[model samples]
Target: MIKDELRRGIIHENPILVLALGLCPSLAVSTSLQNGFGMGMAATFVLACSNVIISSMRRIIPDKVRIPCFIVVIAAFVTMVQLIMKAYLPALDKQLGIFVPLIVVNCIILGRAEAFASKNSISKSLVDGIVIGLGFTFSLCILSIIREILGSNKLLGLKFFPGYEPMTIFILAPGGFFTIAFVMAVVRYLGNRRKGA
Candidate 1:
């Protein structure tokens, strides 16, 4: 049962590819593997910590002000992650830039608080957060990999095909848009088939 919650986050309620939440980071920071990893990890840390804290405080939080409370909690954690990244991983910090701060508004974090963490046990909420965070991370990584390989003809800055010309478009902002859109379409198609079968 606990494992199922984690699985649901990755596939059923996927923050990016499925629910279409957090697309800003999904498209923006995915230009390189390092950027994607940094954004993903930062998001994961925020999501997991926020969920645990919110789940623990659910009963005491007034319904009318719950949204504000969740934002405060999420922002605090996002700031902490931002500082840690800046201090420990300066290069990645530079690569991610504004997206790190923007994690405060990433819908996946607040959505979990309102949809899952508020009602679930602390342990379950923690698992859900981890799973969802990983799902988002994996989705960005895969999309970046596809774009980088096809658009740049390189992986991690080492040329995979030195002889071939890079597509260039895959590395541009427009490429990111179409790549994710295409991937999401494929995911929805497969999801529908699975349900039908």
Candidate 2:
């Protein structure tokens, strides 16, 4: 059961590719591998921590104010993550900028909180957070790699080909859209093929 839940998040229901949640960060911070990775880790930490707390306190949280409660919990975690990042990873923190604080409103985190965490056991919710966080991180990494490589002819800030001209568009807003569209198309194609099989 646990294995199935984990697989579902990573493959069957990826937060970005499959579910299409949290696209703002997906497109913005994905300009580089480091940015994507740092953002992912920070969001993952919040997600996991929030899930555990929310799940454990599910009964005490009144249904009428559940949404507000969730926001407060998520925001607390986001603030902690932001402070920690600022302290230890200031460079990456600056690169991510507003996106770090924006994690408080990330649909993926809230969605999981309401849909799974509030109704499930602490152990299950924890697993859900970890798996879903991994899925989001994986998607960000893939998008970042494609954009960085094509847009700058570099990977992790290392030049791939000194003489090659990079397509600057791939790192811009349009590039993010194009990359997402291409990936979604490929994912759809693979899903169709799997269904047919």
Candidate 3:
């Protein structure tokens, strides 16, 4: 049922935290809440639109060439978001930088198209896309929250722990690695425990 797919997308098969599909942007843009939210929005838009398109054209698309078609559709959506963000959300557009364009290569988008959208109805595919996208967003936001808080001693630019010296390294590339890995471990461990029970 749709509910099952939705649940799986968020936790059982989480794009960022569990499956580790879109780590590049998850790490790169998660230094701040604004950047994390922007990246999540862009990715969600692309995933939702692309899933619908792919579901509609599923029967016509040849399996051998489906990968390229999915990429084209995903890229088109990505470009649309990039243009809109550049014009409207210029600050976030600048913060995301090359990663926005690089979203075309994100495995989560293509994986969904191949794994779900191609076989499911348009509505189901759309829901799956949104659920999975939100899951990815949730993971990124959690990681960014921790990184932003510890690295800068602030949450959404408000200093929460006054007098606490921020760990400057947590905002850097190495910090992203550690933060994501640690978060992934926790998610995986919890998921396994739940499954075992």
Candidate 4:
């Protein structure tokens, strides 16, 4: 059962590539590997922690006010992550900018809180958060890698192909859209092939 859930989160129902949730940060932070990685980790931490807390308090939270309650819980976690990042990883904090605080409003987090965590067991919710976060992280990393390599001619700030002129456009907003569309096309092809088989 857990295996199925993990698979669903990571591949079948990926928040970014499949479900298309949380695209704002995904596009905005994926210009570089560092930004994407840092943003992803921050989001993962908040998602996992929020899921556990919300799941535990599911019964006590009033249904009418659960949305606000979830927001408060998620905001607390986001603030904690922001402080820790500012203290320990200031460079990354600056790189991610307002996106970290914006995690409190990420659809994926709140969607999972309302759709899964509130109705699931603590352990299952935890697993769901982790795997879904992993999916988001993986998607971000992949997009960042492509963008970095094409836009900056480097990976993780390391120049691989010397003398290679980078394409400035690939690092821009249009680049993010193009990269996502390409990935989605590939995913669709694979899904269709699997269904046909």
Report the number of the highest-TM-score candidate. 2
- List lDDT for all candidates, in order: 0.86, 0.91, 0.87, 0.90
Q: Candidate 4, residue 182: CA error in Å?
A: 0.3
lDDT of 3 by residue, 1-197 (tens): 76787788788889988788988778788998867876787788788889999999999999999888888888888888889989998887787767788679888889999999999999988998899998888888888898999999888888979799999999998999999999989988988899899
Error of 1 at 70 (Å): 1.1
Among all windows of 10 consecutive residues in model 2, the one with the lowest summed lDDT is 91-100
Candidate 2 residue pairs that clash: none
Over 4 Å off, model 4: 1-3, 88-98
Candidate 2, residues 98-186: lDDT per residue as tens digits?
A: 78787987999999999999999999899899999988998999999999999999999999877989999999989999999899889
**In model 4, where is the ten-residue run with the lowest total lDDT?**
92-101
Clashes of each: 0, 0, 0, 0
| Weakest 10 consecutive residues of candidate 1 by summed lDDT | 1-10
- TM-score for candidate 3, please give it: 0.88
Residue 139, candidate 3: Cα error in Å is 0.3
- Give the better candidate number (2 or 3) by TM-score: 2
- TM-score for all models, in order of appearance: 0.89, 0.92, 0.88, 0.91
lDDT of 4 by residue, 1-197 (tens): 87887788778989999999998878888999988887888788788889999999999999999999999989888888789889998887788767888788889999999999999999989998998998888889999999999999999999968899999899999999999999988998999999999
Off by over 4 Å in 2: 88-98
Candidate 3 regions exceeding 4 Å error are 1-3, 87-99
